[model samples]
Target: MQLNLTGHHIEITDSLRNYVDEKMERIERHFDKVTNTHVILTVENVRHKAEATVNMRGNNIFAESTEDNMYAAIDSLTDKLDRQVKKHKEKITDHHQKESIPLVDTEEE
Candidate 1:
């Protein structure tokens, strides 16, 4: 998966980037169909906000979070994304049973 990380009103450091990368791995591990991901991190006063949009084979999922710490925000954001991805995966996969042929008796008079 390709991750496009961006920061708003804050400078993204190496540690922050690494942390985001590590968290994203959790999502990719479950659903490998992910084609691209865009992440935005922002700080407003005392609130740390994180949001992400994931692009898959034929769908897009978005989620956001806010917390006192950036890491926590990222964690929450990933958790939301994970649930969405799992739901999407289930939707794409078929789980219904196939029909079997039935025997029939034919009589002509």
Candidate 2:
């Protein structure tokens, strides 16, 4: 999966970039079809905010969190995104299962 990191009003440091990459890598294990991911980090006053958008085959998952620390914000964001991905996966699988079955036709005796 491709990861694009952006900073708004905050400098993108190597350590922060590496931390984001590592956390996003863990998401690959859960969903292999992830096309791309975009992460935006912003700091406003004392609040650090992290937002992540995951692009999948048929759907997109997004999550955001704000905390005092950037690391904590990222952690919370990813956790929320993980839950969204899992829920979406389950919904998609369930939908396919119900739609894939064909109805049988009976002949009148």
Candidate 3:
């Protein structure tokens, strides 16, 4: 998956990039079909905000978090994204199961 990282009012450092990459590995472990991800880091006043949009096979997942620390914001953002991916995966699996099995009707004369 392609990861596009952007920084606003903050410089993107190598360690920060590495941290993000390591955390993103969790997402890939859960869903391998992820196409790409766009991550944005912003510092507004005292708030550090992290936002990411993930493009997957049939869905787009977005999550954002604001904290006093950049690392914390990234952690929170990843948690939210993970939940969304799991939910989306469940929905897809449940849909296929429901469609594959047809209900049988029994009639008594």
The number of clashing residue pairs in each candidate reads 0, 0, 0
Supply candidate 1's per-residue lDDT for 76. 98
As a whole number from 0 to 100, the lDDT of residue 53 in candidate 2 is 90
| Candidate 3: stretches off by over 4 Å | 94-109
Candidate 1's C-alpha runs over 4 A off are 99-109
Instruction: List model 2 lDDT by residue over 51-87, tens digit each.
Output: 9899999998888999999999999998998888888
Candidate 2 Cα deviation (angstroms), residue 102? 20
Top model by TM-score, which number?
1
Q: What TM-score quantifies how close candidate 1 is to the native fold?
A: 0.88
Give me candidate 3's TM-score against the actual structure.
0.86
Candidate 2: list runs displaced more than 4 Å: 94-109
User: What C-alpha lDDT do the candidate models reach, one value each?
Assistant: 0.95, 0.91, 0.94
The total number of steric clashes, by the backbone 3 Å criterion, in model 2 comes to 0
Tell me the deviation in Å of residue 40 in model 3.
0.1
Writing each residue's lDDT as its tens digit, candidate 1 over 76-106 gives: 9999999999999999899998897677766
TM-scores, all candidates, are: 0.88, 0.84, 0.86
